[model samples]
Target: MNHPLTDVTRTLGGIAYGGDYNPEQWPREVWREDVRLMREAGVNLVTVGVFSWSRIQPRPGTYDWSLLDEVLDLLHAHGIAVDLATATAAPPPWFTRQHPDARPVTASGTRLAHGSRQVFCPSSPAYAEAADALVTALAARYGDHPALVVWHVHNEWGNHNALCYCDTSADAFRSWLRERYKNLDALNDVWGTDFWSQRYGDWEEIDPPRDTTAFRNPGQELDYHRFCSDALLTRHRAETTILRRIAPRVPITTNVMGTLEKKVDGYAFAAECDLVSVDHYLPAADPDGHIDLALNADLARGMARGRPWLLMEHSTSAVNWQPVNVAKQPGEMRRNSLAHLARGADGLMFFQWRQSRVGAEKWHSAMLPHAGTEGRVWKEAKALGAELAALREVTGSRVHGDVAMLFDWHTWWALELQARPSDQTRYLDAVRDWYEALWTLNITCDLVPPDADLTGYRAVVAPSLYLLSDHDADNLSRYVDQGGHLAVGCFSGVVDEYDRVHLGGNPGALREVLGLVADEYLPLRTQDHALLEDGTRVRQWVERVETRGCTPVLRFADTTDGGPAHGGPAVTRHSFGRGTAWYTATRLPVTALREVLRTLCAQAGAHPVVDAPPGLEAVRRTGEEHAYLFLINHTLDTAHVSVTGVGVAGAEITDGRVVVPPGDVVVVREDLTIAPA
Candidate 1:
């Protein structure tokens, strides 16, 4: 499980505890003050040179390294390691002026001008060539620098220009399709071009799926998304190849905006990185934002295959992008940082070190806010850094859990197409609901892909998986047959990978495994409600299900017309092979869903780290010789959790008996014990 970038010697202080440092924006004298303040705050690392393309390469073929050398040398003198960026995220004005064709074109056919970051088309040959040259030069210059530990290749790909429909992109897309389909006939059949007279007789006849009169071809759109992802990956690989060639010992990575970003596949992108890194931001106004943050962290760890990942960027307080920017309350920042560490993040960094004085993000919170070092934000940042340094034993740990929730980018894309069963059906919302229910029960779960290995999990939950490939369907079936418990939501297994409905029945390929057939989909309006067998009211959707060998776990109330759906199965359980599958026919209320999940976890013999009270979060991370338990209290009142089975002889428990105050964390370290069966 050891990655090239995770070695203790390669990292700073065994844990990175700084943020993005842009000393280039400040005066030379300010750089000395910045380094001094960084050391005082216990910062061991900083990401430098991001968004400096214009400064580094003011004009094409004219390079300046004076400022960069000064900054790197200053950081090295202060014992601060650098996560060096390639400075290719935003092209300089000169490059764009020289290559006008590099501008990205939107789906509306309007070519975007070059005033913003990521304005260059991903498939533009001129842009790619320019970027490659810059990256090569950077690697050749600083690949062996003493301050460099990690190479950050371009910031957040596909953030702004994920897709481009210009002629250059169209040609690249056509070439991509040619490689995939090999012939026009194969492409026609897969795309279902026979419908709507959209069949293409020649590869040259196709173009990017621009804004259309009606709905665009779903298959074509899906393929276009795939092409866009590949195009960006191509750019990433080019830079990574050059970096690896020059800095053979250094690790290269790019920050991924996890689940929040829908354009790129995280698993595929993680494959290109030496280590998985993610930028996670939470809505400051949402009361349930912590649950979403935990879910995203779990997904990042899963992307790293259960190994520790890097928390590349988060805010010290309120982010400026939201409609209402609310700063974090006292103790909230430390709680957020520990939550990520509890979920298997090896390093914790923020979006920035010092607050920017200008630009769109001038209002964004940073470690050192506009109020200076005397501010509460800076005080909290220093405290958190010291705490993280004290808990160095928790670095490079793994999180163990027996429950998993399935997440797939392709399914997310197809489920939310323009035409769908219900407008209330949001992919992330539904998944978050189930994940939050489990969170309340103190049951930890991994966010896994549909095709991930299921043998290690005692139970799996698939929420609103509308699209399924035959391979994934078979994999789930095999998992159920081999003594795995599964809970599938309504509207699942309804379509193939191409967004085409399965012909046989709803939940077509999974009928045998589920032991039920859905005859019709009943999408209720926003305010509509239906009664479950337990007298629990549900809403938004219901399935008219007929059981073959499945036993009804819940039934719907009688309909107004007394149709066949009246008193039909609302939830069913089938005993398949040595395991079982539970199907939820509608979206149940929170209380009802929690009860159902509790029952399922009991049946699967899944146990939480400790029996925690409400509003208290419990998670465990296991290192080579010890298991660290984190108990965080999100409520205003103090919360106490039992530590009977959580600790071993001679164990150290911080703050005594896992008692956590409001918005505080308690860490308990014990000898590693075997997980309960």
Candidate 2:
């Protein structure tokens, strides 16, 4: 909620650099060596006790603080900050032995054995009561610890206990429903439970929404996903409440896995966190991985708004979890990390300070990789740290940009409710498809939520807009009617907040302004494309609609199954008040799609930061002192870049617009004092 400043003021910088380091995981003598190496590498902070529930508690209440106390004192003595953990994610074996109901039940109805983290059920009052007591004890114990900057609540929640459906969960779900609907009648009407001859006169009659018979409703499945997210948030809120009473100023956060679908609701959780942090892991040559990373960073940046985000954890070399544990090439880590910085990042830390000796993640790479500090990975870490330390100001200073992309959740929820075409058209995929297109153009943009003001934007692309509030609809209408350039893909403006489809045809809410009707849709599964009057589409068949009062800019290539048309307006524009609204009837391939976005952006008065060579990537960061341009080539082959001077007032820092060799990262900050001539 901090808004734009969070992105700029915070800067793509790191204050407390380092990751989780637990000397307790190793021998006493090694702790000294670890501290020495940390100082040598310019490590500023370390996160400790993430999965140490058993370590801290030992045996249910015995309280062995000897090792933990020493570790904390040791790290603090070395001038290293710490992100102290609550250690409540994993329960002591004795607690579960005494209370069996505390075990987490999975979606497939299997019980999670003890020893796994996040095995405690969120709905269990006993579990909450235990977790609350432990968290309070930890906060009260370390409430004034100087080395600690924040409290890391429950580790990576929703991994194990995500879809809990135990008795406690069932009861909690019923309570949550009562609070949400206030009564059973409303719930029945919204869920359409009446149609199945299943009328719940009382709340207890409703069980968890699951497949009891052969018929599996996707709507119910989607709601269950949403409910689970809410449930985890409820737990986070409860735990953070207790901690807040004692340590009010210290931020409370958890390392969130980027784009977790059926787990914690990160957007909602944003309300609780003082600063948002996320885990980032990208594949070496993943076809969609790069774009996926962009979406993830944009999503996290959106959550943080005007504040800087934390790169909580990423593989230094290669993570052991993926199907293939590919090592990061010589420059991949620096390149990818800088890419994260270009977006918006405040801090960088890995999962563990030292690799785990035991557990599922024992093999994950760390600063102190399995090869000690003598290997290439550790050497790179040292170099990265040095670069950050020397360039701290630019690293911390804010970047300025005005344009923002309009991102909406209701639209995401409503897209799946599309009555036609096919039920498989996903909302995020549609949004990602559009976002990736824009990204390829090297244009600077912010991924803003729907509620954000659209007036500042020159162009706004809202893909797969499913549900819109009356006010939101009005805002977009005026934005378009008043000279703003707007673009949205198919499956937009179909529903309201109650998850009800708009009564009219497709885009029922904005049909008047958009000036089009999509009576039929052609689902194209192939990556082939076709051009119409307006623009060409990249994915599957296009929307076949009648150009009512507006104009038909394009047509379909062919018809399907006796349909009159196969394609309708692969792209179209309609003037409202003084502006325009554009709709894309078909999914556009990334290359063609960026061309479309580039055209719209040009119309909106926003141009690419700079043209680059084939493999080179360009991103611009504007500051009061000077504007910084980051050019990086992630590919193996060298790429050439062409550039006119970046608009800077002072000393022209141009090394000639030339080819940036492969795997090269170029940083140029204009010296504003020099005369333009």
Candidate 3:
């Protein structure tokens, strides 16, 4: 792989062992001891200068790279790779005092007073100028250094961000509207904004929708979120452009917080970077790791569209940020790390290789704790290190996929922007519903963005769509009509991006075409589940509708004598256009999802990637010479994995069964000489 990051990757080889390194927060002599301990733990990469902006340039027109210079220089001499940072996490106190507009405003109407990093307003010229200047200075000074492998733009950009509605942002918002609408006429249609006598006569009348600032138009508020995203992107580009000028080939990236709900457009931002990266932190007590870990990894993996990325920050144990902090049990850390890797991550990394002596993260997990490497954390980290050191040769091993779930930003934005009938209707949950279903079927599915073409994929699942452009709808219709298998979930195709429901029926444009009739309905009450006339309870809340002409495999069973069934037409199938469409009226249980997905799987004729037991996960990745199957037993009990795709030489599981222990991993490889079981 002749990647622009090849040289950096050479140094970033095997496993990226080191994590956050803030020598500025420690004594100089401690740096030596830290390095000694890091070497003992096989630590190689040091992410330094994350929050050193205040120290780097204490004032405008001043530079103090001496400390960072020493840090980077020492790491270079020691053969440790350095992910040199922009040191722009925080604007110095003097810069903020001099240019108060440099601060950001929250969605709530308030001017932010900066006391923390990540408070700088992306819309402010002062902040942009300062950030750009700092990046330029750092890259220019150390671009060619052997130790500098990656450019970390800034520390977590969307972590409890500050409010900043200075004059600059307001002016920029108007300008943004000018470019988007060209005139107010086109904007009014998308927003239907004049219904409340809220028509804008000029661009100057436009402003960000702050919570305290009067009116609340869905279109305006949503666009404001989009505007904020674009503004931040503009600022991010400013710094990346500087890095491009200096280290044109060095991979540039930033660690995005897992499952970030901020207004920032990470999907677009990923396109600008050479490599995508994210921090991972999921609580041990989470009923399921999907919300905090699995789904986050899937989203990040999807952000890059199957491209390999770095797990920028994750706790080796519990994180202080979660409501309840719980450490990873005996082998839980490795299991969790492998979980992300199975989702297409090429590298695994964590936050704070060394423990922070103070701050909110002081109690968080670390490899070498304040108690030192002799402890349990260090032992676990060392084991992880050994796995990577031994498996270095498979650095670029890829996860092969022919199945993908269509994920979209437009859909995410549109769906979230809509005020749905139920409060539980959400973009992430909708996605999770589909994912949890597929994962249960022992099927490993890739998350794909709508911008990607559907080629060679057996099936594409799009659920709770709630939004789609006319062009996109046509594109989808064509895919299915052309002998392709597609599965869609509830509440889809109901509205356009403007939050206005398409006329005719619940699923609007896709209704008749998908062979389904979703008429306006009788919603079920809370604590009650939908029931099919067959007497089976539909998974979650649902709507009752009339299904005529379509094959109603199951009908809602109304318990109250005179009432229309409180649930949906349990399962309905119909022929639309040139393909077959099946719709489930209500959400399904995990078991039901798997059963339905299995049927869909057989319909699509796709095969499971592994023989994983319940509570375990399995995925296979194939390359030119071999296919690697990762069997991760997420359960505490040992599980059996059946053999698949094998022959004489290197067929370890050919005898039919392989026992994988609790929280253990099995990396079985084949020469492609085996059958596709």
Candidate 4:
């Protein structure tokens, strides 16, 4: 499948830039003004008809093409390409009323009312048929439209209604289990149902892990999560099948919420898309949201298998959903957008072009805010559009990473079950902690799956990988044996894919490779802390480690002071085969973690792209002709980076340095002929 970036660059002649265009929300006359503004802002592409199901199909069988036809024609006439949606994201009221069985039910057996979007059950046959019928009609109508460049299957799958515990979904789950396990005996053995006397004699006796009195079966809960994700994928594939049959040439995609999202498995979702597209909104309350943004961009690019992906949706300013919606500063939005581009986003877009007037998201930031063209958001959008227009040559380029960070949704699900270590130990927090450590060092890294090929990466880091399959464990062992560096964080490799224990000490799978035996887990109490030998602060979790052959680099502080932790290794390094494996038995602060990773990376030959200050982010994208070096200055003061290339502003006389203003971005096109070592 061809990536949308490559296709958009070929057909539209530059990077794709635009936002969602909802013509149904406004009068026809307002659309002309919208297009005029879009052209002024340098938008070359816009998504249409995402939430227009009710507008398109008011009744069960009736169709209205007047509004969508005019919208597409007008966009084409204005030289703007269209990312036409399947319009199945939200079903109309009439259809829901007719097929009430398709309505989603809660885990407690309550049928949810259809007032919000994505309210239909994912496994409901009626819902699938209805969605497919709508998708078929849309594809058959606009499959060959001149303005159509991409097929957006559905909007943010599993965002609102991820799992449906209704009977319809129950039947589908039973069928899926039958196909997966082949028989009740296999299912029982895998689920470890004998412990709770929950073993099923017949497939019909099974149900989803609903709200039970006691702790539900971890195995069943984990499988239910997997089933829900796959059910959503099945619906997505159904829509894509019809689109492929009708418009095989157009690239198909659905936006995925990156690392922070725990519902859908991003790896599975990425495989289904022709190209990866993601929707990321900044953490409104966090002081360091940009770090989260960088993690998301890296994860999205990783899902694309290192191919250039698209920024499908973001906010121009404050999103309406946060507890206290704080607006973006003067240049924050620009920095945010360019930051994604610097990572690997070939295209940039927003949630909306024009802000809504009478919807739940009316206050959500958009290209055209409620204050109209006179607002600061509008000006920044225009400036960013022009900047993107100039950087068209960077499209289809690749961002190469020096290290690979392992992330898995299944591990996330299994690790955070009801009964585990302290709830303070979170899966995403561990991933982010390690990622931030790498990011702070200016070390470019790829977010990869556990079983990914680690031949090229100099170092691989696995954080909070609590669930491990035998195949993936062997893959990691093989990677380390082949002279690849491996760093295993705490609570990793503790359980198999069935959510059952490894039947030995903690971190069971990689214990042999790590050359250590974890005798017990020591998750800290709330507000408690532990200290390393060198006074490095550790918190949340720790492990009592007994090294077999590896040497301990950091151990618990002595017991004379009487702290929460007294002895044993906090971190260890094992020389295995031709490579090295590092183990972190306790959670270290970002500063401490960075130093540890820095040491490992230096030994493994994984260095930074450029040695600049901590706050200045540097990433390079290489193409056939040139290599574009993107520098984002997130610090309070200006930064002087050492580099020699043609600036985006066409500045040529380089004195081996580029000065980036605070909270700003700089892109320099270097010669690709001088290949990177």
* Candidate whose TM-score is highest: 4
Instruction: Give the distance in Å from residue 490's predicted Cα in candidate 1 to where it truly belongs.
Output: 1.2
TM-score of each: 0.96, 0.90, 0.93, 0.98
Task: For candidate 3, write residues 392-507 as lDDT tens digits.
Answer: 54455566554577777666766665345765566777677778877766676666665467766777777667676666677677777776667777777877766667887767
Regions more than 4 Å wrong, model 4 = 1-4, 560-565, 650-654, 674-677
Which portions of model 3 miss their true places by more than 4 Å? 4-7, 162-164, 212-215, 283-285, 290-292, 538-540, 546-550, 561-568, 644-656, 673-677
Residue-wise C-alpha lDDT for candidate 1, range 1-677, written one tens digit per residue: 56654673246766778999988777899888899999998888899998998888888888898999989999999999999999888998888899998999999999999888998999999988888888988898898899998899999989999899999999999999999989999899888999999999989999999999998898899888889989999999999999999888888889988877899888888889998889999977778788888999999988888888889999999999999988888888888988999998888899899999988899999999999999999999998888887777778778988898898888888887766888788888788888888999989899889999989998998976898988999999999999999988888998888777888888887888899999988888776677765667777888889898999987887765322366998878999999999998888766777877888889998877788888899999988878888888888898876673343322334444656678878887766565655
Ranking 1 against 4 by TM-score, winner = 4
Candidate 4 local lDDT, residue 517: 88
Clashing pairs in 3: 104-163, 104-164, 105-163, 105-164, 106-163, 106-164, 533-555
Worst 10 residues of 2 by lDDT: 3-12
By lDDT, the best candidate is 4
Worst 10 residues of 3 by lDDT: 645-654
Which wins on TM-score, candidate 1 or candidate 3?
1
TM-score of candidate 1 on Cα atoms, chains taken together: 0.96
Residues 466-514 of candidate 4 have per-residue lDDT tens digits of: 9999899999989899899999899888899999888778779988899
Q: What is the alpha-carbon lDDT of model 2 when measured against the actual structure?
A: 0.70
